[model samples]
Target: MRSLITHLAALTPEQLSDLIAARPEALLPPEPATMAELAERLNAAPLIDVALLGLSRPELQIAEALAALGDGCDRAELAAALGVASDDADLDAALVRLGEVAVAWPDGDRLRTVPLGHVWPCPLGLGAPLSALLTEQRADDLRRIARRLGVPAGTQKAVTVRNLSAWLADGANVRKVSTTAPADTQELLHQLAWEGPYLDEPTYRYGRRTGPAQWAVEHGLIHVAAHWGAPLQMPCEVALALRGPDYRLPFDPAPPSAPTRPVDGESVERESASAAATALAGMVNLLEECGRTPVAPLKTGGVGVRELRRLAKTIGDSADHIRLWLELAMATGLLAPTEAGLLPTEEYDTWCDQQPAEQLTELLAGWLSSEGAPLHQPAGTGQPVPALVHTADGAAMPLLRAAVLRVTAGLPPGAAAADAQAVTTLARWRNPMLLDHLDDANGLVEGVWREAQLVGAVAHGAVTDLGRALATDQPEQLATVLDRLLPPAEETVLLQADLTAVVVGTPSRTLTVLLDAAADRETRGGASTWRFTPSSIRRALDAGSSETELLTALRDRAAGARVPQPLEYLISDTARRHGAILVRPVACCLRSDDPVLLKEILHARSLSTLGLALLAPTVVASTAPIAETLTALRNAGYAPVGEHPDGTVAVERPTRQRAVPLPRASDVVTAPLPLPGPYDPGALDELLAELFEDADESHPLSGYLIPTQPGPLATSEPADLARRLLRAAARRTSRR
Candidate 1:
């Protein structure tokens, strides 16, 4: 790059003109590009020529894929890999883009990338390595598909046609699961635009069953239900998130792992992965609790203090542990507030059902993409930390998180740079004139690192596989890299004599949730322990589980352990005691045709002790009250009668509920949240174009004499005129 400019600087006027004629694009960059300034982007993907930026993301991918396949690779191969029709005009257009200025060229019947393809290990600012993207398995698949498609030998587009035919015919068989916000969810999000910065639970009414708020809750579109009876309205903050400019649900791309580390790398890598798995497993366990019994939100909004404490006790961890894990779940849109209590959203449930590795990847992405600093505040600080939005200083946390990730993304794999140095270097590169509210770079980086670790994006002082994908903001590739490292999920558990069930690897969310309901987690790791307690078994029975469901869940998750007798006894006993207490509210009570039933109710445990002074063999006068006695009667299994003053049997019914009418269209606000400005490439593009345009298109300047502007006595000297016109023409020739 230095020499290209220096050589131009030294070229005599004659030589300059002649050199420009021989290789015009070299002197004048080909038109329409953003890549010249791509170096400034945080990811710093492999550098490419300015011209290459002219293509869209898809076009760039096509161009680069062709380059990877070598000169022998043809349009058929590229089109197949890219999943585009070989003869499609769009494909032709992309090919033409590569050919401009010899970045690629038509070689006989096949098209090949030239300087652009040859410039880097891969081209067009693609961070993916060729080895990863075009694996032997993939190439072999292409070949096999070609044979299946009956492509003729030596066919010009043989490889591509085969790949394309195969992908077209069988690709649908490959199921894809990704987080999505459906129409119902989107409508609920739309309501948040004008309704508020936050919905007031006590006063605000649910608009409709179909509205965004309800849909968001049902779908986990907003992690917390904010439900004031349950599933709270979408928060102003979550609404803002849903309104991101790029409306597609955020996803990390298929991963492309970085270069392997040298020395102690194997041990360090495993340790890092282990740490990530551990952290993620903790959050998942907490999430399992929410699924079991969602906690109600405080009247003020957010999880209540008492409820948080209860969760801590139940999880068998300290309150601090509860707060950290709970907030992290909320921050990641996996937990939300509800009238019933803070619980996992529908989105969380759907996500939880995915494979273990995918579950971790999704959480890591949410952790990185979150705009708030749930973990940034000092412990015991009076100020309540924002769940997942702007930081303490009001600067967008997403931007700060991105900055830190960028620094790590640029480091060599396994290299551990000082956090302060990374912060300082980032600050120097930051655009101070535009953004505001971020002054504590060191603090921001440190806090972000801590949160990153807890969310499993980083481990052992380095970015994990998921972290690198997240740091690069290439969510589409997370699966690619992570799949290689993901251990198979544990489908069952080991039951011991002590009623302890152990999981060997990444535990299935389904199994975990079921086990947590029927058992208590005693320890977590490769082989997590969950002891089946009597209370835990009762919890399962109380949750409306049939005995078979409980037995099946236990048997399936128990790997091959013989069902312990005590465990079976606990389940059976809990089932017996499960519905003994059935209470109902009514205006009146205390009569029954059956004398034995009334007597039984009066003597029932705690109930009779409370106040069932019998007035008659078939009737009881309660010093307690009708409602209290009614509850006691049910618990005692008496099913006593409630009678009106007229001696008629009484019945209770609830009022019918209806959806609230939505506000007038004029009243509902719909607006997008502001986002940080992306870097501009227009200026760099113009500079490259201006420096390279030819003085004239035809006739080598070395052979032909220069001509003055037509019909002018002398518009200017030939040399000066040539230079000025060259500059002017470039501005016009360069496409944006």
Candidate 2:
């Protein structure tokens, strides 16, 4: 068969570029001078592993079927092996996907995959041939089996084994032998054929063997090799014949259809914007709370359970919901980690300054690229997988999330939306290989949908116009799309007699800021409700808001609506009660029986730094500390003497101190450590063999192997192969 380099060399420059662009994870160097160099880079083990992980279920299955066939096969032979028609559309598509990633390349009239022996030793779970397996059997035992099956008992052991293998390769002969075996023995053979080709050895004594296992083995149906231990191995040819025409492997390549419910386009758009606004408002509230009283992190790093629960109560959301939001904030750099706790970062200020559309986009983009699932954990491991915390198994989360969103975005325009089941099916079809690594694949997909909904990327199970724009990476169009879908922002609110304010629609930036500071938000949604409580009004006053300024700002926001009497009374009462006490900072007190003496000290310009102020005719206070004030008075040439708080004269004294270094510990000699021995070639070979023996090659990663020339695919004419290659390439380009 032709090498992958030769196959790639046949493509046009543009076609080659498209192929390379399709699989960036291969990490092939830029601009290869020759096809050989490019092919060599593509074949690197790590790069090949990455490419294999990207194949869809059908694509991977087809690749494995090709590998099992050993020598390459033509399209017709491949279709036959997979139990599908040669002209099937999905078959063609799967082949195209494999070809795009250079996993499978076109040979003369066939296709060949990279050498997969080092990876997948047993493709499709088929076992070794009888010829190799019988090496552990006694020659007498083989001759006895040959005689019972009516085969020639050749003197040579190898000759007898080869004849038995050829006889078993034919379906009719195998069926004839199966009819003579006991009913239980026949069932065991059929089970091993489809499920896998290995079975544990029965525990019967060597000379007193019984049961279906021994019957099958005695009939030459299964063989045990000494090197492979006690497990009996079924030859590949026997398993294929027993599988029959139905084909044991799953072969469907069509994308699953999602169940959708129709909704009004206008309603979806409106609800989507409302959800987006609510999300943003919640973020603002969380940040303000954090700024006021930042919670401490756990010793192991991450928010403690109690702290997260407290935040959930403060934010009026579930702990899980709060966790997701915190993760989003952390992911977008809005919330940063510090020694104290998670606090709003400088990026948050910039985010707040952006338009609503841009703000939502920033959050959605962060979610798309974040490393781990915030809600779901690995299968069988009940530990909670926190957001923003990296887990090795979660590396595929971003890719899986993006794939699900892409599928949603690909839906037809209008108010239609896909349910979880349909979305899950298509996502699995698109990334079967990746999903195989995840324990809770369904939960992970559902989590992505929930996260998208949180950020207003989808509404009522459908991708809104805004969501579509975000998923497609059309940031420039987000503002225009969101603007068209949402109603205009209102700059006014309705003031109620119950001391509550209600915003009828999206609030203007200025109105939002004013309400957030002066009133506490009671309910948030399409119309947010704010209540003016005593504490809230006092908080505004403490922030330097005069009663008159606060009233004027409220009336302006209220527009033509009359201000409620209770709200007016509450604001005035709170303002009147504020600052009633006269509190001042004073470090030293100057008391004198003569009023004129204290007056002279307050009027002294040389004592200006002391910040002296006369409280009464006989008492004066200074802002400076006691020592500094006394020194200033003495330097000003005043006959002032320091007095203690108890009315006694104070005296000063000085003492000297020093720190001495401790002596260093003595070092003692110790025996030298033994050196490592030299490497042994035989040991390395044995280790490699053992690793390959135990390796789980049944995984998707083990689906390619080098092909021999003159394989089944070479049966077709070269012209047919060229035509097929062109059609596949055209389809791939159109997809791009």
Question: Which candidate leads the pack in TM-score?
Answer: 2
Q: After superposition, which runs of candidate 1 have C-alpha atoms over 4 Å from their true positions?
A: 1-267, 285-333, 336-343, 378-389, 392-396, 409-415, 418-437, 473-477, 484-488, 524-526, 544-549, 573-609, 613-736
Candidate 2 off by > 4 Å:
26-33, 116-120, 127-192, 195-238, 245-249, 255-265, 377-392, 406-426, 466-515, 527-541, 545-581, 586-736
TM-score of 1: 0.46
Among all candidates shown, the one with the greatest lDDT: 2
lDDT of 1 by residue, 1-736 (tens): 2222222334345543443222222222222122221112111111134344333334455555655444445667556655556787866765654443234556656764433434444332222222222232234434543454343323334455444433322322111100245565455455553343233333245633444454343322232232323334332223323344333211111223333333244654576567566666767767767767766665555555677677778776655455556655665567765555666666676676787677767566455434455555544566644232344543345445655555555557656545544543543233221122356555556777776666555555556666677665464666765665567677878877777888877777777777777787888866788888766665566455756778877876665646777778777866765544332223333555566755776676767455655566655566655666655554654334344566553443212221222221112211111112122121112122221233344533211122222111112222332354345445544753
* Every model's TM-score: 0.46, 0.64
lDDT of 1 at 94: 56
Clash count (model 2, backbone only): 6
Error of 2 at 92 (Å): 1.2
Q: Considering summed lDDT, which 10 consecutive residues are worst modelled in model 1?
A: 37-46
